[model samples]
Target: MKKIILFPILLIISFYSIQNHATAVTKSREAYEKTGNVIWEIKTKEKLVAITFDDGPHPVFTPQILEILAKYNAKATFFVAGNKAERFPEVLRRVVKEGHEVGNHTYSHLITSKITAVKLKEELNRTDNIIQMITGTKPTLYRPVAGIYNDVIINTAIKNGKFVILWSWDQDPRDWRNPPANQITRYVTKGINPGDIIVLHDWHGSEFSQACQTVMALDDILSYLSSKGYKPVTVSEMLYRSKTNYPEPFYPFR
Candidate 1:
């Protein structure tokens, strides 16, 4: 009996190990166009990292970040809050127009738990309708407010037809509090490896232009990482690179 139990236990462990190691393959290539950011967030094994921006397509500063990203020809994921989208519809358009991936950040920026299933779908649908109207493409990625996700929120999002996206790591500089550039860079450049999905803000709009640290500091971070042979692809790229069905390599960070 012991032998029987031991064999079964080991078999279960082995199956889990393999499932944990399985590569992520999207059966729907059509899913790729809309779900690229979320797909990459969950899949991929490459040395790619998705540098994601949340909170805005801010009225003023988002354009600055866009200019910088454009200069590098880099791709990123932006989770735009729905109300912000409604206010700055042009910015939302500019995000997609500029080749950045956009995902739902919620309609009112409410936490996932506070919302009922009905309200949750409404938030997602509202954002979906708005984005589809503007870009003619419906988004498949949704990040709950502040990443405060639960089973209900996840299920609701999926039912509303979105992939639940949360970060695997955290590198936030609390740039919202306006930490120094070097401090911010340190948080990012340190503890960083391949397959990291870094969350940065284009604008918290908190009088926190402290991201100015990155203005001078980005080159340093990029140059050093480049020397280390790191390729900073979008978060979607990292998900695709992991090919790991599990979120082992995630670093959902600021």
Candidate 2:
């Protein structure tokens, strides 16, 4: 009787341990799924870089940035928040009219990791609707607020028919901190290479001064990139032009 009880107890303990270990492994994989499953850059030998701006369609600064881009005969991608797009429909329209690409940056600029799946879908769908209403074309590219994401965010975006977009060469320049325009330009242009996706901001909430600084830096940044023989293209264009086989819209996970 002692041996019989011991054998069953040992089997039960082994089963419990195996279950716990599997649970731990699943959790670990989910956590790892957050950061690595994003597209940072495209592989290409072509002298092209994609300059992207987020939190924009600002009533003031967006036009200035567009003017600078036009002056350089360069194209870029603007990841506009739905709220901002609704507020500044003309600005958003100008972004499309001027031959630049538009991307969805969520409806309310909510952080993806902090929201529920339903809320995430709402955010993306709302933004897509607004963009489609304004531009007659929904955005296929999606950039998460603050560049933070997770498995849920990625899956939600893909489900909503968006390709998750992140930058490859962020050298942020802390422009949102109201740094000098030259500093912002240096941070972006320094060590910038082909296939790099640069992130700049055209809006800074109520900080009009910081927005002005971004505009100020644009001319210099454009000039530097032009002198280097680097043509600024939209993210879609970069991906299409890339020589390497990049996964469409999402990064592959093993």
Name the top lDDT candidate. 2
TM-score between model 1 and native? 0.71
Error of 1 at 202 (Å): 2.3
Error of 1 at 78 (Å): 0.3
Q: Each model's TM-score?
A: 0.71, 0.80
> Best candidate, TM-score-wise?
2
Q: Which residues of candidate 1, in runs, are more than 4 Å off?
A: 1-45, 206-220, 241-254
Q: How high is the lDDT of residue 65 in model 1?
A: 74
Q: Which regions of candidate 2 deviate over 4 angstroms?
A: 1-37, 207-211, 243-254
Candidate 2: residue pairs that collide:
none
User: What's the distance in Å from true for residue 218, model 1?
Assistant: 4.6
RMSD of each: 12.9, 8.0
What lDDT tens digits, residue by residue, belong to model 2 across residues 113-226? Answer: 556567889988899999999998878889989887666677778777677787864656767676898899988988798889888888976636434788899899999999
